[model samples]
Target: MAALGQHAVSKVKNAESQLVQEWIAALEASGGTRNVKGDELKADTREFLQLITSSLENGAGTAIGAAQWEDTRQFLERLSRNRAQMGQDSSQTANFIFALKGPFFALLQKEFASEPQLLAEQLLQASELFDALGLHTIRTYQASREAVIRRQQEELLELSTPVVKLWDGVLALPMIGTLDSQRTQVVMESLLQRIVDTGSEIAIIDITGVPTVDTLVAQHLLKTVTAIRLMGADCIISGVRPQIAQTIVHLGLDLQGVVTKANLADALALAMRRLGVTFTKAQ
Candidate 1:
């Protein structure tokens, strides 16, 4: 009974010491913002440190979900020194790296003695965590990156949706971005539905915002034309800029047999003529 009581007391003291160290580390983690480059990066690093400490406390580093952080430490050490570093977001990673060292190594030498799988999983998470926090720290390729990712996701959602008609029978789709295969699918559906609902034989596709059309864009356009034809409508490719035409030819991509016009004016004129609305073209 006496021996067990002494062991328990020792454990309690160690636990108390660990708790004090954690608060100290947390304070330091928050204070090291000067060495960090940006306010956003500093905030992200601080948040990541909190998450690491939480995970360690949860036995996530020593138990089945615990990650082996040896490689992560070495990786962070390299990141800390590299100015031309590809992994800058992880620059302050070292600050939080050694914070959990004592507990992890103690657990690593014994707890994970036979649980290699848990070690592997934890290592995987460490890598993922590194990346999630890494983006915010990078100096180069930083500013527009966040916005670009956001726009890409938004554009992807937009592409999956069909076009809505503003008129009773006439259909109009104003495209703003590149027409990739994924987005082209949405555009095709919208055009087809409008033709069926209004019994309209003509659809005007305005592409004033499309910067350049590559092979994929050309393929998407072809697919749209095919779908519109099956729906019994005449599809017009409008707003074909001079530079876009040159790009199409430079790529050696064939867009032959597809109806195209110099601008929406010419396209609408031809569509109106097809619908039996004839107008005199002045010489």
Candidate 2:
């Protein structure tokens, strides 16, 4: 594809301020300026426009993948990630680049008004260039958003599995929601680490908030119990409700060799008894 012409580049450079104003106005009118400060938006538009004009002058063709466009690519990557972090959608992020097309085409039209064919050629090149950049911004935005989501998920996992010291030599893990292999791994790691940290002799896995219990959940529970045992700590499975008990029986899942309780209170009592600790009610 043909590169942006020298005449077009000169016009864009000379009309940089005008182009930026028009571009920013267009973006603002289209509601693309949401969540962005005025000064910051202007600064970004100014910088991007400058980079584009300079890169074009230096022979950066419509092929944005060219080496000459490396700086521009980096700029867009940063822009995309920042926009994603700012809670902007992919279309809005990409529109930051696509929005410039109008101002650029207007400049080219004025620059090549006398030469219709040349105007068309330059317009096409500019469109192609901006489209490529916008697509790159979208792709980068998606990747950044995915990274943010994954981080949030990991944080949620850490939050959901909290190990509390109920008494001396006893740790309690209150679990909510479903139990999958991924969550089981996190649970085991957290419980085991707490056991090591406090040198606790017993750990209770409470599932009062768990909505349902299937064979998979039982298996996960067993796995966690086995891991805790391997860590030299006894594991007590608590919160075995009537429905869950029936499910376990219906599934014929064997929780053999694992102590279970109807509630956390009972489990704590059992743990305390096993530790040979006795507590009396205050009179």
Candidate 3:
């Protein structure tokens, strides 16, 4: 904590500009500046240096979790998030903080050259503080990455369960993957909303691209069909290939009330007939 005292703090404050330059250089050499503009990088280094000096002057010690280090934490978190968004890994994000160690230690060594013990103490304090900040940056970066991944997964789910308007008062939802509870929920929400928006009376759930249909998947389809009936829309389950039909029979899964079709064309024709729509062949 003695590093927060007047002597060490003053030295850092007076050498802040030079420290930022050296730190930026260190960052550049460590590949921390990749994909970052030089001017923006310099600004960040200067701002971080100022935050550190200000925290030290305000008696914020090596314990980065203290309230006095709030600004520093905020800065590191923002930096970490930006780096994560830029597709940088945790090590690169952490290097942004760790690179400062070299320049900071050099500054302390030069300033406290006469007092070897004091120099060692200040260096230790700087090392611990920087290490803590680096770890914080890594944690924040990892959280940001997880958030990005979760959002992508949701987007993929929506993409996979696309609802198309196959005809007037008819909608088709073609599914392309294994049915899970989460995807089932997404499918229900999207189809139900489309039904409401289009006032559609029929929705065809096409599962030809679905790799397999176990008991759970059958249950999911049943739930979705039940939901569609509650919304006053009829649902047709399509893509019941021969293999799937055999599997359904083997599983003894009941589908007494639900309508099934063999493919998209048959489902669309059935839906069109239900709507009293007919086609004529022209020669």
TM-score of each model, paired residue for residue? 0.48, 0.97, 0.95
Model 1 steric clash pairs: 60-66, 67-122, 89-137
Tens digits of per-residue lDDT, candidate 3, 69-103, equal: 99999998999889999988888889998998998
lDDT of each: 0.57, 0.91, 0.90
Once superposed on the true structure, which residue ranges of model 1 sit more than 4 Å away at CA?
1-63, 66-166, 193-200, 214-216, 246-257, 273-283
Q: State each candidate's clash count.
A: 3, 0, 0
For model 2, where is the 10-residue window of minimal lDDT? 102-111
Hey, what RMSD does candidate 1 come out at? 11.2
Top-TM-score candidate index: 2
| Arranged by TM-score, best first | 2, 3, 1
Query: For residues 1-283, what per-residue lDDT tens digits would candidate 2 score against the true structure?
Result: 6798887788788888999999999999889999999999999999998888889999888888899999999999999999999999998999898888887887788778899998888888888899999988998999999999999999999999999999989999999999999999999998898899999999999999899999888889998899888888899989999999998899999997899999999999999889998999999
> For model 2, what is the C-alpha lDDT against the true structure?
0.91
